[model samples]
Target: MPAYSDAPLPVGLDALVGMGMNRVKLAIAVALAEHGGCLSTPELIAALGEGVAGTTIARNLNELEDHGYVTGDVPRDERRRRRTHWTLNHANLHADLRALIQATTPSGEPPTVTG
Candidate 1:
């Protein structure tokens, strides 16, 4: 059988996944993008379901935040244990991110590559 593209993800995304962009991180970003680009930790946990632990999500969120891929917003009056809303960094990556997200979806097809 001829070799076929499995998911049709763009080259950049493939490279990103190869470069240690774990599934949870990608899922978080995709979830945020799909849901108005912002969500609290609890909302994310709910969206991601129970397979992933809450602590794991929190740690990955921090890692994403540290990498400038996402940001956590804490309200001034919020309590210590309250949730911090995470917002995907769109200032410099909105279009690129949307394109990547679209390309990685189930129905997304990769563009023909020519050299």
Candidate 2:
């Protein structure tokens, strides 16, 4: 994958899901990236703004962490309860983003010059 600009660009649904990232994971990844690459579980949920259940978000976060797309742990929260803090793996994210952009591009033969 090629290097892209710092800003997070638009990613097509087909392209995103086609790269082995499920809907929830894709949404989470994008949200994390937009949030400067670090966000707690609750922050991530609010970032997504999809109204998905916390359990669902946790499940997707676990899967994303396992895939090296994100990294963090269930550390003690403000009240001393364990909570997940996820951070996007920028390297993997950039690579996946490049692939996603490539997937959305229309590929075909070059136009012929008749002039």
Candidate 3:
């Protein structure tokens, strides 16, 4: 098992927000979450739609990986060329989303019913 930072999830969420992710990143995150944390680049692109380029996908994946949101490894065949496989870190994923949503709402206020 991989080691995870136990610091408040909000920190990580804030980090992601600071990184300036757009719809592409969100889609990648959702796809990784839905798959229970593992998918190929080609698979992700196919799942997301045709307009996404391989280089763009690679870049986003690298960003997510750098942020500790995903993990990947390269496997080589007889020619020694490498292929990478990515796995989402759900622990981080859900925690980050929860924290982000919580941060967006007004603080010190409870929801009131208006029936």
Candidate 4:
């Protein structure tokens, strides 16, 4: 895939606060959005940073999956070892964010800022 920007999601971070999402979880989301809307555990770790432990990413990913934000599969590699390939559930994500925006806005209009 090609390189993509992650700007749209950072804008939703503040909105997600009402729903109890933290920056780390949102970071993982943004990274996945940037990476062609899909990335495995190792890919997410690399995109996040080497300093971030793999287990942490895995744990967060599992949580995201459970929360209906992301979904993926553990496919076996050529060596018969399993590896994860995560794909963003964009439909779910967009709908959730849209609901957030509509909830916070008047008449369900998205809030506009002059800055």
Which candidate's lDDT is highest?
1
lDDT of 4: 0.70
Candidate 1, 27-85: lDDT as tens digits: 88889999999999999999999999988888887777655677789743462698789
What is the C-alpha lDDT profile of model 4 across 1-115, one tens digit per residue?
9995544543444434433476667888899999999987778888999767777777777777766788777632331345788888777777677766655678755565321
**For each candidate, what TM-score against the reference?**
0.60, 0.58, 0.67, 0.67
In model 1, the clashing pairs are: none
The lDDT ranking, best first, is 1, 4, 3, 2
lDDT tens readout by residue for model 3, 1-115: 9995656544446556523467778888788778776777778888888888877877887777777777776632321344577788767766666666666668886533221
lDDT of each: 0.72, 0.68, 0.69, 0.70
Clash counts for the predictions, in order: 0, 0, 1, 0
Across 55-80, the per-residue lDDT of candidate 2 in tens digits comes to 79877776666666788866323323
Q: Which TM-score value belongs to model 3?
A: 0.67
Clashing pairs in 4: none
Q: Which scores better on TM-score, 1 or 3? A: 3
Poorest 10 consecutive residues of model 4 by lDDT?
A: 74-83
